[model samples]
Target: MAQEPLLRCSGMDKSFAGVPALRDVHMSVAAGEVRALIGQNGAGKSTLIKVLTGVYRRDAGQVEFAGNPVDFTSTQDAQRNGLATIYQEVNLVPYRSVAENICIGRARRRFGLIDWKAVNAEARERLAALDVHVDVTRPLVEYPIATQQMTAIARALSFDAKLVIMDEPTSSLAEREVATLLDVIRRLRDEGVAIVFVSHRLDELYAVCDTITVLRDGRTVADSPISELSRYDLVSTMLGRELTESERRGQHVGATATAAAPTVLEARDLRRAPVLNGSSVTLRRGEVVGLAGLLGSGRSETARALFGADPVTDGEIHRDGEPVRFASPQEAIRARIGFNSEDRKGEGIIPDLSVRENITLALLPRLLRRGIVDRGRQQEIVDRFIRRLDIKLAGPDQKISELSGGNQQKVLLARWLCTDPEVLILDEPTRGIDVGAKQEIQNLVRELADDGLSVLLISSELEELITDCDRVVVLRDGATVAELEGEDISEKSMLHAMAEGTAATGSRQPSGSREEDEVHD
Candidate 1:
């Protein structure tokens, strides 16, 4: 007879604010296996992990562990049951020593007093067993983020955890650090531990996971062996699209265009202490220039500094051959520069406002006369963009939050476009949206550039950057490491520049290395 699975969850259902985040999702993990949970943003991947780790209670589901039903009312209860979760943010006390952080609740003790010496020694030994080295005596914050992440993993393994749930564990890790984590995962799997790995990095999922489960719109779309799937097929399944030649052709429509115009925006020696080095790049009219790099590579920081969302300590910004300094986003806007922030919910949109209101937000002054908005003119402009962008909404009066992520993004694009800006800076524009919406957004970007608008595109998806950009500027360790254009924008080229930081530019190499560099870069 076959052995029962180590963990099995059936009919898991969860909702947030009347919206079903996870619906009847079924998943199972066998001992000594690594399973990947993947989907677009808002596809319920995070929700499933939260439910599994008791971060959120499922509205409906049956959780069976080791062939027996179980109920966990809290994360502590779940951890006590041999289940542990390591979040992307690394949820451990940074001020505490590594040993204390790892074995806080179950510290070694003697006669009701903490055994500090034994705890530190044991913690160091445990980490060494996992092939991770760290100074257990020092505070956790003293080490790099990658080391902190490994400590979290070591702590989970120390629990004798039957199943370990990793939620984007490599999100902030460097290429080398990722390899270490992957090695640790393999060791744990060989030792009969089940792992559920959640990540947006398709390549990492293929590397570490033996089986794949894809979620879409709160439902399980497929659960199959990784060997039975191709990357394109996996992306299509997660995106709810049928595999076809036309769809693939339309995936990267912006890359074919070449820039043949004067520069719209240029940054010379842009620098911010500790984060952004003396980096420089130029954006020309009717072209999409991509800022490519891993997290903390100064891509977002450059955008912020250029848009005056953040102060710059050094460097100069030139518009049409003249130096310009923006003291605030308002100044940037007035100068015809628009920035679409990466954090949509937190920074991009006003959820309580209506779609019409949000779409015309940047142009409210234009619609105002004597401190009063012209409702008819506002409605006209909103209606035009709503139709032009194919923004799916019940009506103009619908709340911005009520729309899908794709529609919210379209609203944001309209919010800036209505202002008639010359330059648009989009950070992760297609993030967390469905496949259809992603293509539409990409095509819209191409159309916008063709219509003479300069764009600065920053995305973690390297494929998106390569295909949508007229030229790619690679950054590493807060500096411009390499710039690729025309024939040099292939995936291999970008990967090389990002990984080695030696792309014919003779730039300084990155000092720290981690796994996330591979995925994000």
Candidate 2:
């Protein structure tokens, strides 16, 4: 009596090398369903998506699509069979025109020649459907990241796919762009397109997804209609524990006491041409200061400038009230400053290296004597931080790529901690990790600040800034607009400043807490 689902996977099992990435996983999506696939990093969400999309072969599983069992050998084969995927990273060629990137494989042909006019027109129309307008002839690298993301979405939908799998689609999108994408998703579902939406943004999941499937440690832990699951329960299920009242509020433990702490690093009037206009931030010893902003508001740019990864065109950086210029990351490191980048897969981890090597990467210079690494000292530091961070890996000798996303992140953290830096800059440190890993990183940051390490934290999550920051600096259009501390730092205040580019200096009580009002009155 019930309609058969459009896409279904049962008893799916996959392994890499000797480690199992998925086990006994089951999922189903109706013809017009928007299903959410969520889990902590390395919980097998990516693995299952890869298995379904033909990126990786499943050892054991039955994948049924449109009333037939299918095993695709490659992504192209899967795409041709009416299943399309937009990966977490945009897979389009950056150097090619936007039209070429969108219509590369399936370009319209006429008289044995590719139809350039038809291809460009189709790409333009597809992007326009998503409310994105751009020159299709221009190279994709010429567009902003948000535009590129929309282009990817347009390409996936252009396939007339029965089931479209989107992984972290809004990770680089601005709030307005995210709303547009969600609307497009709703339209797709209404038109009978099944969508498997993968994102860490809970609000987006609730907004667009019809069903929810949760994975944990390579197993299907929970599956239900989206309405039947509450946010708390969703997180609890993914984390494998019920969150406490404090944890629910994202309150990090060991809030630093740094009222009298001296400033360790300061950037004044930092200017970088395209992305960063003018931004500034100050980090004090024993303090965790958050740089809050929307995408493209210069949050990462500011962090990178401070780390000397991207040299600022005009700015002054100071250490201990003395002016300093770091032309490179090596110079910054030598000055006891460490940086963890947001692009974990691309910039943060060296996948080919072993966990031990990646962990000791930054500190290797100090561990070397006469151009030879002091293996004993390197191992001592690596072992200490691995245990301290609770990194989950087979052994230190294992390739870093073999570890889960969270463990890889911990190794990156260990890499910087081993440097014994006085100041650390973390950009979106918990971006794609699960709630449990997020909390652990937050706790570690708080503890580090408590132990007198100054941290400049950049995160798009307002709750993260409110929970862990001693001071919150809001950026708008690549410039600092507000700074809140003490009882003034709240979600409402930060959102106000981030949107309006004005200081939210406690004009009114934050809706997040009545305790502040009670205490104030």
- Each candidate's lDDT (Cα)? 0.83, 0.82
TM-score for every candidate vs. truth? 0.67, 0.63
Q: Please, what are the lDDT tens digits per residue for candidate 2 over residues 1-521? A: 05799888999999889799999999999988999999865789988988998989999989999999999999888988889998878988999999998898889999999999999999999988888889999999999888888888888878788889999887667667778889989988898989999986666787899899999989999999988886646756765653343322234343445767788999887876545555778788888889987555688888888888888888789999999988899999999999999999999899999999999988877888999999999888888999999999888999999998878888999999988899999988998888899889998988898888989998876678888898888776566767777766776666556434565556332222212112110
Highest lDDT: which candidate? 1
lDDT of 1: 0.83
lDDT of 1 by residue, 51-85 (tens): 88778988998999888898778888888889999
Runs in model 2 with CA error above 4 Å?
133-135, 244-335, 339-421, 424-521
Q: Distance (Å) between predicted and true CA of 36, model 2?
A: 1.3
Give the Cα error of residue 32 in candidate 1, in Å: 1.1
Candidate 1 backbone collisions, by pair: 173-516, 174-514, 174-515, 175-514, 175-515, 176-514, 177-514, 178-515
